[model samples]
Target: MEIMLTPAAKAGLDEWESNGNKKVIQRIHDLVESVQRTPFKGIGKPEPLK
Candidate 1:
């Protein structure tokens, strides 16, 4: 499965990294990887957009 971020999300991530939130950025990447590995059973509960 592929994960694509919206433009706003990309900008927010960039801003977070630029503001020295490397750890948070890494955690986001980790979560993405986890979701990729197990879409319905990863770190956080998976929910539908509704």
Candidate 2:
């Protein structure tokens, strides 16, 4: 699944983090990192030349 935040979600995340919600910030950061590790769309080893 593609993990992402919409503009509104991003705005809310920033606002909440600035409001001393470290736990929420940490969770979101963790989620972002996890998603980053996923392979990009169609990423794979090259096919053999027949």
Candidate 3:
């Protein structure tokens, strides 16, 4: 699912990026990564290209 970052979320992300807050950025990255890894939204096992 495509995530639409809200204005506040965008600001937070931008701030973290600009501030070089690796911890906060890592948390955000982890959240997104976990979401993408889920089998939700009809996602199944990854398939190799034929």
Report the number of the highest-lDDT candidate.
1
Q: How accurate is candidate 2 locally (lDDT)?
A: 0.69
For model 3, residues 1-50, the per-residue Cα lDDT tens digits are: 56678999899889989999899798878777766666353233444558
Query: What RMSD does model 3 have?
Result: 9.0
Question: TM-score of each candidate?
Answer: 0.76, 0.54, 0.60
Candidate 1's residue-wise lDDT over 1-50, tens digit each?
A: 99899999999888988888778989988898999999888887888678
- Which wins on lDDT, candidate 1 or candidate 3? 1
Question: By descending TM-score, how would the candidates be arranged?
Answer: 1, 3, 2
lDDT of 1 at 45: 82
lDDT of 2 by residue, 6-36 (tens): 9998899889888997887887686666556
Global lDDT of model 3:
0.73
lDDT, candidate 2, residue 27? 78
Q: Where's the lowest-lDDT run of ten residues in candidate 1?
A: 40-49
Residue 19 in model 1: lDDT: 89
How many backbone collisions does model 3 have?
Answer: 0
Kindly give the stretch of ten consecutive residues in candidate 3 with the minimal lDDT sum.
39-48
After superposition, the stretches of candidate 1 with alpha carbons farther than 4 Å from their true spots are 47-50
| CA lDDT of each prediction against the hidden true structure | 0.88, 0.69, 0.73
Clash count for candidate 2 is: 0
